[model samples]
Target: MNTQLVESVIQLIRSLSPEEQAILQEKLFFDFAYPSTPDLITLALRGGSFEFLNDEPDLYSLTDGEPIPCP
Candidate 1:
């Protein structure tokens, strides 16, 4: 990797506003969480590791919680 390019990216991130930085943080988290390839959830389901969950009874109904009114 080019050292100058790495430093440029750091400078760009430092220039972001607080809100923009927060958004960037979330984007980084989500990229790590799901990844670019098939996600972990899909892999787990296909591997049948969590198939036992199908036997669990539903704990909550659709009407269980009060809905927040979105702006």
Candidate 2:
């Protein structure tokens, strides 16, 4: 982490009005709490390998919503 950049950010935040600071705080909290899908995908890819659990092996009739008899 860059100490200078962090200090700069802190200074900028300190300069904001109370309302603006609160809004910024809320935004930061939300950003950390619920990350975007792309962020999640990147994290998952970095953590480990990804593989499909099932490759759609069911019959085409099953996928077509046909009322097939169940064995």
* Pairs clashing within candidate 1: none
How do the residues 3-59 of candidate 1 rate in per-residue lDDT, one tens digit apiece?
999999999999999999999999888767755555766788798988999999999
Clashing pairs in 2: none
lDDT of 1 at 52: 95
TM-score of each: 0.47, 0.42
Best by lDDT: 1
lDDT of candidate model 2 versus the reference = 0.82
Residue 20 miss distance in model 1 (angstroms) = 0.2
Q: What tens-digit string does per-residue lDDT give for candidate 2 at 32-66?
A: 79879999899888765554425646556645865
Total clashes in model 1, counting residue pairs 3 or more apart in sequence or in different chains = 0
- For each candidate in turn, give its C-alpha RMSD to the true structure in angstroms: 8.8, 7.8
lDDT of each: 0.88, 0.82
